[model samples]
Target: MTAYILLEIRRTLRDTTFLVFGTGMPVLMYLLFTNLGGGGDHDEWKAYSMVGMAAYGALASAMAIGTGIASDKSLGWLQQLRITPLAPGRAVTGRAISGSVTVLPTILAVLLAGALGNGVRMAAWQWIALVLLLWAGALPFTLLGIGNGYRLTPQATGVVNVACLMGLAIVGGLWFPITEFPQWLRSIGEFTPAYGFAELGRSVVAEHAPAAGAPAVLAGWLLLFGGYAVFSYRRSARTA
Candidate 1:
């Protein structure tokens, strides 16, 4: 399991495209948007944009696990793995861990952009807390990716992954504040896991306790995605 996790991490890091788009794009977006905005509270808006872009990058990184899984399945790597000692559940868990690991660079890149480029400021502990919260918050997305990998073809997985990211970003207010949305859209965004994940980090920046609903919504998604991932993995294993 440890070896597999390491291998997955290595593979993920070697994908130059993933590194560019997953980490670079978010930082670029943050820089562009922060510069363009003429806001009432500049620091607060910068911090909010920082968190949103970081969360989006993390989301892209975590969900790419599904596309990798689909590719592995197509290549019969998953079937080959069945002969190994690693349990099916552990395989999924390992992938999830690796997927989560991929989010670190994205988070850091956005943090640096916020601090150095845009003058977004926070306490030392708040920075640490924000990183940890955002990283931990990516678990549900990883599980969702795993489930999608087991269920879709590689081509379909790629398409669906991008669609999911776009939908989540738009609906969860990652591109802007939820308050800017119409009341109906705001209500819907509040319920999404993306919103919850970003809110967790935003709470640290805001120097306040997060609303209970944020963590609660995240927990609910984690449970749902986890169960789906397990079922998908086991089903794939059996069929393979």
Candidate 2:
């Protein structure tokens, strides 16, 4: 298990594209949207803008991590891997670990930008809570990607990844607040995992607790995605 996980982590580290998309792009977006605060109490501004930017970073992490499985399938690497002693479900387990590991750099980079580039600040507990929440919240996106890989081809997976990132950003209210959108759009955003995920991080700073439905919605998606991930691996193992 350790060897497999280490191998995946090493491979993930070597993915320059992953580094750029997951970390570079998110930091770039943070700089572009610092004014997202639109002038308010400094702490609140930091909280709002930081949450928005971090949400996008989280989106990138999820897409990059999830898409690799589909890419490997298209290349026949998954079949090749089966000849090894690595157990059937272990591949998926490694991928989930890789996905989580890759998300770390993106999360750290955005946090740095929020602190330095935008002067975002908070209580010690708030900082710890927000970071921990975002890190833990990223798991759902990884699972979503795994489900996608099982159902789609590599080419289609790539397209869907980009679409998911952009669509989620727009609808999840990461690029901007859902409140700024029309009532219909806002209603739509409420159902997205992006919204649920972002709102979880925001809770650390916001005066109010998250909506009761947010965690429930996230958990529901997680279960759906996790089911597919397990089923996909088992099906592929049988075929292999």
Report the alpha-carbon TM-score of model 2 versus the true structure. Answer: 0.83
Candidate 1's C-alpha lDDT?
A: 0.86
* Residue ranges of candidate 1 with Cα displaced over 4 Å: 37-41, 180-188, 238-240
Ten-residue stretch with the least lDDT total in model 2: 231-240
Q: Write the per-residue lDDT of candidate 1 for residues 57-124, one digit (tens) a residue.
A: 88988887798898888887877786688887788888899888678888999999999998887899
Clashes of each: 0, 0
lDDT, candidates in the order shown: 0.86, 0.76
Off by over 4 Å in 2: 35-43, 82-90, 180-188, 235-240
In candidate 2, how many clashes are counted? 0
TM-score of each: 0.90, 0.83
